[model samples]
Target: MARTVVPYSSLVANGSLAQPAGTTIDQSNGMYIAAARPELTILRVANTNGTDRVVTIKAGDNPPALAGGQGDLAVTVAATSGVQFIGPFESGRFIQADGTIEIDFAASFAGTITAFRVPRGT
Candidate 1:
Protein backbone atom coordinates (compact mmCIF):
# COMPACT_ATOMS: atom_id res chain seq x y z
CA MET A 1 0.00 0.00 0.00
CA ALA A 2 1.13 3.51 -0.68
CA ARG A 3 1.95 5.71 2.28
CA THR A 4 -0.03 8.84 2.96
CA VAL A 5 1.80 12.02 2.08
CA VAL A 6 1.50 14.81 4.59
CA PRO A 7 1.52 18.27 3.07
CA TYR A 8 3.64 20.87 4.80
CA SER A 9 2.29 24.13 6.15
CA SER A 10 4.96 26.79 5.65
CA LEU A 11 5.50 29.18 8.51
CA VAL A 12 5.88 32.90 8.04
CA ALA A 13 8.25 35.16 9.90
CA ASN A 14 6.71 37.94 12.01
CA GLY A 15 3.26 36.94 10.86
CA SER A 16 0.32 34.99 12.14
CA LEU A 17 0.28 31.27 11.42
CA ALA A 18 -3.01 29.57 10.78
CA GLN A 19 -4.00 26.48 12.68
CA PRO A 20 -4.41 23.53 10.40
CA ALA A 21 -6.97 20.77 10.43
CA GLY A 22 -4.35 18.11 10.01
CA THR A 23 -4.76 14.96 7.97
CA THR A 24 -5.93 11.81 9.62
CA ILE A 25 -3.16 9.34 10.38
CA ASP A 26 -2.88 6.40 8.00
CA GLN A 27 -2.05 3.75 10.55
CA SER A 28 -2.09 0.97 7.99
CA ASN A 29 0.06 2.40 5.23
CA GLY A 30 1.81 5.00 7.42
CA MET A 31 2.88 8.39 6.09
CA TYR A 32 5.63 10.34 4.32
CA ILE A 33 6.72 13.90 3.62
CA ALA A 34 8.81 15.56 0.96
CA ALA A 35 11.82 16.55 2.99
CA ALA A 36 13.82 18.74 0.63
CA ARG A 37 15.04 20.76 3.61
CA PRO A 38 14.68 18.25 6.39
CA GLU A 39 16.28 20.50 8.95
CA LEU A 40 13.34 22.82 8.67
CA THR A 41 10.59 20.17 8.80
CA ILE A 42 8.55 19.50 11.86
CA LEU A 43 5.76 16.97 12.57
CA ARG A 44 2.83 17.51 14.81
CA VAL A 45 0.98 14.45 16.10
CA ALA A 46 -2.22 14.74 18.03
CA ASN A 47 -3.66 11.79 19.92
CA THR A 48 -7.34 11.88 20.71
CA ASN A 49 -7.66 8.34 21.96
CA GLY A 50 -8.04 7.24 25.53
CA THR A 51 -4.80 5.26 25.43
CA ASP A 52 -1.34 6.47 24.65
CA ARG A 53 -0.03 5.84 21.14
CA VAL A 54 3.50 5.53 19.81
CA VAL A 55 4.63 7.29 16.67
CA THR A 56 7.79 6.19 14.96
CA ILE A 57 9.91 8.16 12.57
CA LYS A 58 11.68 5.54 10.55
CA ALA A 59 15.38 6.25 10.07
CA GLY A 60 16.70 6.68 6.56
CA ASP A 61 18.81 4.17 4.68
CA ASN A 62 20.97 6.83 3.09
CA PRO A 63 24.74 6.48 3.49
CA PRO A 64 24.20 2.92 4.54
CA ALA A 65 26.74 0.29 5.64
CA LEU A 66 28.22 1.99 8.68
CA ALA A 67 29.65 0.48 11.87
CA GLY A 68 26.70 1.67 13.90
CA GLY A 69 23.47 2.56 12.15
CA GLN A 70 20.83 5.00 13.26
CA GLY A 71 17.62 3.59 14.66
CA ASP A 72 14.03 4.72 14.37
CA LEU A 73 12.82 7.39 16.76
CA ALA A 74 9.74 6.38 18.74
CA VAL A 75 7.68 9.01 20.47
CA THR A 76 4.77 8.43 22.81
CA VAL A 77 1.85 10.78 22.58
CA ALA A 78 -0.09 11.01 25.79
CA ALA A 79 -3.70 9.86 25.69
CA THR A 80 -6.70 12.15 25.34
CA SER A 81 -5.89 15.23 23.33
CA GLY A 82 -2.15 14.84 23.82
CA VAL A 83 0.02 16.51 21.26
CA GLN A 84 3.65 15.98 20.30
CA PHE A 85 5.85 18.09 18.10
CA ILE A 86 8.73 16.22 16.51
CA GLY A 87 11.62 16.88 14.19
CA PRO A 88 13.79 19.20 12.30
CA PHE A 89 15.23 15.95 10.97
CA GLU A 90 18.83 15.42 9.90
CA SER A 91 18.92 14.76 6.16
CA GLY A 92 21.59 12.12 6.25
CA ARG A 93 19.77 10.23 8.96
CA PHE A 94 16.15 10.71 8.06
CA ILE A 95 15.74 11.52 4.38
CA GLN A 96 15.05 8.50 2.19
CA ALA A 97 16.53 7.80 -1.24
CA ASP A 98 13.40 9.15 -2.91
CA GLY A 99 13.81 12.42 -1.00
CA THR A 100 11.17 11.86 1.63
CA ILE A 101 10.85 10.88 5.28
CA GLU A 102 8.76 7.91 6.42
CA ILE A 103 6.61 7.71 9.50
CA ASP A 104 4.93 4.75 11.18
CA PHE A 105 2.44 4.21 13.91
CA ALA A 106 2.77 1.49 16.55
CA ALA A 107 -0.94 0.82 16.42
CA SER A 108 -4.23 2.24 15.28
CA PHE A 109 -4.12 5.92 16.06
CA ALA A 110 -6.84 8.43 16.68
CA GLY A 111 -6.69 12.10 15.60
CA THR A 112 -4.73 13.97 12.99
CA ILE A 113 -1.13 14.65 11.94
CA THR A 114 0.29 17.81 10.46
CA ALA A 115 3.60 18.82 8.94
CA PHE A 116 5.19 22.21 9.27
CA ARG A 117 8.17 23.74 7.52
CA VAL A 118 9.97 26.66 9.07
CA PRO A 119 11.28 29.47 6.96
CA ARG A 120 15.05 29.73 6.44
CA GLY A 121 15.34 32.64 8.86
CA THR A 122 13.37 32.72 12.07
Candidate 2:
Protein backbone atom coordinates (compact mmCIF):
# COMPACT_ATOMS: atom_id res chain seq x y z
CA MET A 1 0.00 0.00 0.00
CA ALA A 2 1.09 3.59 -0.69
CA ARG A 3 2.07 5.50 2.41
CA THR A 4 0.10 8.69 2.90
CA VAL A 5 2.28 11.80 3.02
CA VAL A 6 1.47 15.26 4.39
CA PRO A 7 2.23 18.69 2.99
CA TYR A 8 5.42 20.33 4.18
CA SER A 9 5.08 23.58 6.17
CA SER A 10 7.36 25.88 8.08
CA LEU A 11 6.85 25.06 11.71
CA VAL A 12 9.39 27.79 12.55
CA ALA A 13 8.31 30.39 9.95
CA ASN A 14 11.70 30.22 8.27
CA GLY A 15 10.40 28.06 5.41
CA SER A 16 12.57 25.25 6.62
CA LEU A 17 11.19 21.80 7.19
CA ALA A 18 11.50 20.62 10.73
CA GLN A 19 13.18 17.33 11.38
CA PRO A 20 11.07 14.65 12.88
CA ALA A 21 12.02 13.11 16.19
CA GLY A 22 14.74 10.47 15.97
CA THR A 23 15.41 11.51 12.38
CA THR A 24 18.98 11.44 11.15
CA ILE A 25 20.30 14.69 9.54
CA ASP A 26 23.95 13.97 9.04
CA GLN A 27 25.17 14.85 5.54
CA SER A 28 27.73 12.10 5.69
CA ASN A 29 26.19 8.64 5.88
CA GLY A 30 22.71 10.01 6.38
CA MET A 31 19.35 10.19 4.60
CA TYR A 32 16.72 12.90 4.14
CA ILE A 33 13.07 12.20 3.46
CA ALA A 34 11.24 15.05 1.75
CA ALA A 35 7.59 15.92 2.15
CA ALA A 36 4.86 13.79 0.53
CA ARG A 37 5.14 15.62 -2.83
CA PRO A 38 7.92 18.08 -3.45
CA GLU A 39 6.99 20.80 -5.97
CA LEU A 40 9.63 23.20 -7.33
CA THR A 41 12.06 21.61 -4.93
CA ILE A 42 15.73 21.19 -5.82
CA LEU A 43 18.28 18.77 -4.39
CA ARG A 44 22.00 19.29 -4.84
CA VAL A 45 25.25 17.72 -3.64
CA ALA A 46 28.72 19.19 -3.38
CA ASN A 47 32.01 17.56 -2.43
CA THR A 48 33.77 19.14 0.50
CA ASN A 49 36.98 18.70 -1.45
CA GLY A 50 37.69 18.65 -5.17
CA THR A 51 37.10 14.93 -5.25
CA ASP A 52 34.71 12.48 -6.79
CA ARG A 53 31.52 11.32 -5.10
CA VAL A 54 29.46 8.20 -5.49
CA VAL A 55 26.04 7.75 -3.93
CA THR A 56 23.14 5.42 -4.38
CA ILE A 57 19.44 5.28 -3.46
CA LYS A 58 17.54 2.00 -3.35
CA ALA A 59 13.93 1.88 -4.42
CA GLY A 60 11.17 2.18 -1.85
CA ASP A 61 7.80 0.40 -1.77
CA ASN A 62 5.63 3.18 -3.16
CA PRO A 63 4.56 4.90 -6.40
CA PRO A 64 4.85 8.29 -8.21
CA ALA A 65 8.55 8.35 -7.50
CA LEU A 66 10.78 11.44 -7.87
CA ALA A 67 11.28 13.02 -11.27
CA GLY A 68 14.60 13.48 -13.04
CA GLY A 69 16.17 15.64 -15.81
CA GLN A 70 14.89 19.06 -16.90
CA GLY A 71 12.71 20.69 -19.59
CA ASP A 72 12.41 18.53 -22.74
CA LEU A 73 14.76 15.77 -21.67
CA ALA A 74 13.15 16.06 -18.26
CA VAL A 75 12.60 12.39 -17.82
CA THR A 76 13.04 9.98 -14.92
CA VAL A 77 16.64 9.74 -13.79
CA ALA A 78 17.91 6.20 -14.29
CA ALA A 79 21.62 5.88 -13.49
CA THR A 80 24.61 8.03 -14.21
CA SER A 81 28.32 8.27 -13.47
CA GLY A 82 28.16 11.02 -10.85
CA VAL A 83 24.45 11.95 -11.05
CA GLN A 84 21.29 9.93 -10.68
CA PHE A 85 17.61 10.26 -9.99
CA ILE A 86 16.59 8.44 -6.76
CA GLY A 87 13.21 7.06 -7.93
CA PRO A 88 9.49 7.55 -8.03
CA PHE A 89 8.31 4.06 -7.19
CA GLU A 90 8.44 2.63 -3.71
CA SER A 91 11.55 0.70 -4.73
CA GLY A 92 14.46 1.50 -7.09
CA ARG A 93 18.22 1.68 -7.38
CA PHE A 94 20.47 4.80 -7.73
CA ILE A 95 24.17 5.50 -7.92
CA GLN A 96 25.77 8.98 -8.25
CA ALA A 97 29.32 10.11 -8.82
CA ASP A 98 30.74 13.63 -8.57
CA GLY A 99 33.56 13.79 -11.10
CA THR A 100 31.64 11.60 -13.47
CA ILE A 101 28.61 13.90 -13.69
CA GLU A 102 29.42 17.47 -14.64
CA ILE A 103 26.36 18.60 -16.60
CA ASP A 104 23.68 16.12 -15.78
CA PHE A 105 21.21 18.61 -14.45
CA ALA A 106 20.00 21.56 -16.52
CA ALA A 107 18.12 23.56 -13.93
CA SER A 108 19.82 24.88 -10.83
CA PHE A 109 18.96 22.95 -7.66
CA ALA A 110 19.34 23.62 -3.98
CA GLY A 111 18.53 21.31 -1.09
CA THR A 112 19.98 19.45 1.84
CA ILE A 113 22.03 16.50 0.62
CA THR A 114 21.63 13.31 2.61
CA ALA A 115 24.71 11.19 2.14
CA PHE A 116 24.63 7.71 3.61
CA ARG A 117 27.78 6.46 1.88
CA VAL A 118 31.30 7.76 1.49
CA PRO A 119 32.18 9.10 -1.96
CA ARG A 120 33.97 6.56 -4.09
CA GLY A 121 37.15 7.40 -6.08
CA THR A 122 37.61 10.27 -3.72
lDDT of each: 0.84, 0.27
Model 1, 11-68: lDDT tens per residue? 8888878899999999999999974567898889999889999999888774531211
Off by over 4 Å in 2: 1-28, 38-40, 62-122
What's the lDDT for residue 5 in model 1? 92
Tens digits of per-residue lDDT for model 2, 1-122: 22112122223333344443222213333343333222222233333322343433332221222222211122333222233333222211121121011113222221223212112232
Total residue pair clashes for candidate 2 = 11
Best model number under lDDT: 1
Give me the runs in candidate 1 sitting further than 4 Å from their true place.
64-68
What TM-score would each prediction reach against the true structure? Answer: 0.91, 0.28
